[model samples]
Target: MGNNNGRKGPGRREILKSAGAVTATAALMSAVRASFPGGAFAQAAGPETDKVTLGFIALTDAAPLIIAKEKKIFDKYGITGANVAKQASWGTTRDNIVLGSASGGIDGAHILTPLPYLMSLGTVTAENKPTPMYILARLNYQCQGISVSNEFKGLDAKADASPLKEAFAKKKAAGKEVKCAMTFPGGTHDVWIRYWLAAAGIDPDKDVSTIVVPPAQMVANMKVGNMDAFCVGEPWNDQLVHQNIGYTACTTGEVWKDHPEKTLGMRADWVDKNPKAAMAVLMAVMEAQQWCEKMENKAEMANIIGKRQWFNVPPADIIDRIKGDIDYGDGRTVKGSDLLMKFWNGGVSYPYQSHELWFLTENQRWGKLPMDLDTKAIIGKVNREDLWRSAAKNIGAAEADVPKTTSRGKETFFDGKVFDPADPKAYLASLQIKKVA
Candidate 1:
């Protein structure tokens, strides 16, 4: 979606330029590695498999995977043939992971945080065959947004959708629909939009039609009037504003600050067969996340991921949000904010079970999971925090970097509602709008 109409592949001239850049980056990383005690590139017991393919969708949050490949971090960790292939949509990502690498699919992916759980529960699988999966680390937090078309211009709406509900009702009476789009049905984007809509007394299930659109295709779809509003990760939301097609109503962080977004997910079978390799991949991504979190590296990161092969968006569009320079596209701007997308800072890389539990509860709220389901058992099997701890130790991460507790305790949302991990059911009951059947 970043204007790749004429490009087939990088021309010879472009290839040479990329090669030179890689060479310079390699030299820089080599010096940094040498300075660290025992060297960051020092290999432990070699990985079980030397090659592994991973899938990613075209979103800014997929930077960790791209950075790992570009900076040779995967190779340093002995994952020699690590491939970060781009995926068309979240549904395709699920199918490919279900197929597995032996069947010519990816062994892992930079995936929506809840997708691996859905896959493991046979919720999204075509054949209803559960594909066991594990979340190695959380890739990012925040930086997703809900954008509304020009039709809602000058509307006094922030976190509340009350202003839009009457408009939607009038449209419905006229046999027209007010639709909202998200990347996946039960994903973070969907949940965010749903929460925002419900907070304003608009029932997401009954008041509006919800649809799925891939991240890269969001702007194009919106431009052609496929949907009235959409919630997705950047830079599609930012692009909509740049093109004057829509304006960001509010960011997900504004809805709930520092909320978990994406994850580095892999098949549980693959991890079982290749424990050391899984740890190696985790270490590589962890280092890449740390590198991406640095203030100085953001511009370079935006440039690298904005290339045609990755996100395919312009660097200018991606750089602002990464640096916390947010333009809400409705005559509002924030020079910088701590609520920007986080890769490693604020214990973001650590996969908190409490967050996963919240996601699970939301899925249940939306009728994606049964209310009576044993959530703790499902979380135990899917969340491999033990592997994360082991990987952190092997990588010589500081003790403070690793959390002493698995849970981040009770989390409070922008709506003044609290989600206590210890009492998930009560939290669910307190929500006025839910479809927990």
Candidate 2:
């Protein structure tokens, strides 16, 4: 997942039928007035922009883009002509936007968290100049899952749920260390999985080797024993379960409920130049976000995303967790958390400064960014809260939903003690096992 273009085998109609129920529910809810508070869409700002081009990477989290188009949210907001192209990968998504900024083709992108940070700091290609990009709003959260190959049955019975804990025990029994896979280095998937491992007393960098595989390649790598486990977004996790090659180890929701997973990214220059259009796009997507959060729309969204041209899997494969159902395939099946794809729950979707800083701190922890960089200045410049506020306001989002100020909440990862974002020095000092350069 995390915006992959891979496909697995087909699924059963019974699964599809359940999927249909989700679809029907979404369709019904789409027709209902948004029950949430204000009319974010009513008396919308007059037509300021007529055309737009958007990009996505073909994952379930791309639902906001798809639903907005399917439901004509863009048209509703006065943008008549829009292009939503599916990029090959997250890297490509960032590249396209960067190139578009230079060539005047791409406007904004559905991008990963590390993108703006890396780009702002000139960590990527040199040809691409600094394209100002900021967080519009969080698209969705807490849907990524860690899956273990079926061959690793011992993982299911490990004393701790953390894969790193199991990896340590398995290594003690054998001479070899376990292999864990993540999509990218200095990325959210890598950080979340690594934090989970370290919390269980396993050193991610020392106890096991972390490999970089495209989200699409995770299953194949696992099947070939190149990796013992992977943490990725869906429908890849669902694809693994459907293929009978792996079992769900733990969902990201278990680690941090409603954790920020994806966001709507725009070139900072684009936002500054086209503030009205930017706010309109956010409103349209927010409308879709509300639609997807409903129990009913899950199936239709799955069906659409499951097409070969998009996510390219069977609807059944993608429907379970989309509708809040979890299947570990270890004889464990549970309802998916409501926090599964929270578009706007408890100010969850709003980009918090502390949250952005968390990613920055993690980047430094892993040496993606220099250990001595001025992370606070970089984070403050890159995470554009002012832009997010305009878009949320345009959508009539409640003021209460927007936190007046960021909270450096005490956050404990899979590691034993909680972290104080305010005192990152202590937090970094507390780590016994770390990435040594």
Candidate 3:
């Protein structure tokens, strides 16, 4: 619905992404100037496109959508009629996609990773049946982090023990629940926080209580002590550091470097019905991703995305992180700006079946789903790789641009085990934490 950064949120990296979008657009404009020689700019020839609508939840990683719209990437791809609507929450975003509320009238949405999974495996509790959504492309990765309150700074557990041990000890010593929060259960943030905590020998179920709070409300809840710590996407984590209320204990990327963050999700039915429109949308977003990766465009990206109409936060706050600058506070900051976040760099944008399998395995491990479901079958039904491949090809994405043939990629879980997707059963069985199921 909204974002967590208190003062109009979009922190540093978002601003930089916005600037990059503009610079890319300017470069394209310059090409026109040289060729036209003071003549009128030629309108790109394509199908009549306008009034295309999309949805977002106001996170920093949503920058590419804003940048694309601002730079007319949609128009460039003949996708006019563009309107971006900020949904109330991830649930609402999910509901719209499932019920055909968003796609029935317009296009699709910038959705969370759990969406497709939930769609394939209905929310039995909610009695919601599978809606079968598909992702057009990936938006960004390695952008979320876990934040801890500054009040717990001096606790010896904070430094000497794992986060799980530290949180539990602090809570018991204070005679209060060491409450930790994440945006959603069965979502990437929750999975990372729980997996990370469990890796350090902390029982997420008993040692600490995990709660779900909306991203925009995380900082407020932490400020009022409604929660002790939270794992969320930028710029909320960055905002906490700046306010000195909290600090980044670990990045999701640290949990699994280059982990999936956000994606452009559409219903499978919608893709089947409007393949051309879907491909066009993918092309526009992919171009937007390329624009975001240009380092020189960082400043201009900040200016555009930091504006009142977009993320609407101070350009400085969003700039540092978007540019890959890290400020862990307590006198710690790093300038690995390239690590900030990325949108596109070829095959990195597709939704891999292996990625889905890892999430499914984690869900099963955490007791969110019953242990007997067929992981491969569910993944095949949910991933929609055929559609993604078509979109990628239409956009000129090469075969090598996609991820490895299998899910196996490089990962170093802080707990010390290296996960190889090729041997997932072994990876799941090797865990030392409680297996609720």
Candidate 4:
């Protein structure tokens, strides 16, 4: 009885409606919420279930989920023994989340922030039937890189990618296709590289081929001269520079300062089925984000995630840029830069509805989504900021520390483009290099 997508269809409600099991389930969740008013479910009050399988790619931003499991914070919050499985790629992660753990896949994941929305709308799924996903928290801000091959080393594109337009033009005129790789279609990396190229007057869709490459494969693909430029999360980008294969043009944060990246996303049905357990898992991951954001934790964090069982990367590849030290690999170096990744810098991990709007708008500009799509209604269905708020208070976050508003006000990008969440259509109309006319 599987659906056209990875998940099974005609759920428990359909099969058990006459048995009253669904009613009992709802009653249990209501009772649990009443007992734990702050949303902090611990061992004493207990959870409906003690385990769920979560997935993550080998990116540094997946640290919160791994740290929670490694440090037994999940155990502390009554989500004891939750599995943090490693995903081979973003596409696999999507399929698995749809499949759910009971069906031999995953329950949730450290996913691209835009992906949950796309999946929820069924835009990227096989039959275009919504998966009903939920974005619980933004995992990190910044630290993704747009890197160029050493062939363009002299160009040194820097923050403005205009320098590479001529080189790309020459490549195209030579009767060869120019390729730019990103981790997933309509995901953060795709949007970033597209924005970078379009800002320089290069058409990402028409001027160059946008290919899908997993984050882990980006370095090897570049080493073999498979792509001219790529956008991805660390520690792969740092590894590229270490191998002398490429130099980073700019960290994504430079393009749009404090930009949202990965997210802790899960199937909405899972949250509904296990409300208390979901809150417990959210609280544990939030606590881990706080620990991961500390300056002193950088070395240890790098060492832990670098182990073969995890990212299998070298700590040296991860530690440098993680602590704000950068070696651009083209004779430019920065010490203690502000462009380092932020795990829980104040409300950095809060899932702002405003940030999600920009992602949808960017996807619209590129034709991945319909221009007339109901962005606000979709955001309302997919973003569970209310759940995030509950977890924050229960996790002992000071009231002052919690964000009062869902919007981060207006966001401005490097090329002087501004995205006011209040006027996404205006932002879309202002873009010169877009698929939308």
For model 3, residues 221-271, the per-residue Cα lDDT tens digits are 898888777888877888888888877776677666677778787777766
| Candidate of highest lDDT | 4
Off by over 4 Å in 1: 1-45
Candidate 4 residue-wise lDDT, 97-139, digit = tens: 8888889999899999999999999988878888999999999
Cα displacement (Å) at residue 148, model 3: 0.4
Q: What is the alpha-carbon lDDT of model 4 when measured against the actual structure? A: 0.89
Candidate 1 lDDT by residue in tens digits, 366-407: 999888889999999999887777767766677767888999
Mark the regions of model 2 whose C-alpha exceeds 4 Å error after superposition.
1-48, 101-105, 127-129, 157-178, 336-339
Badly placed stretches (over 4 Å) of model 4 are 1-44
Best by TM-score: 4
- Relative to the true structure, candidate 2 reaches a TM of 0.82
Candidate 2 lDDT over 237-333, as tens digits, reads 8788877888887778777756677778877777666555666677777778877877777788888778777677788878888877877767777
**What's the ranking of the predictions by TM-score, best on top?**
4, 1, 3, 2
TM-score of each predicted structure versus truth: 0.90, 0.82, 0.82, 0.91
CA shift of 171, model 3, Å = 1.9
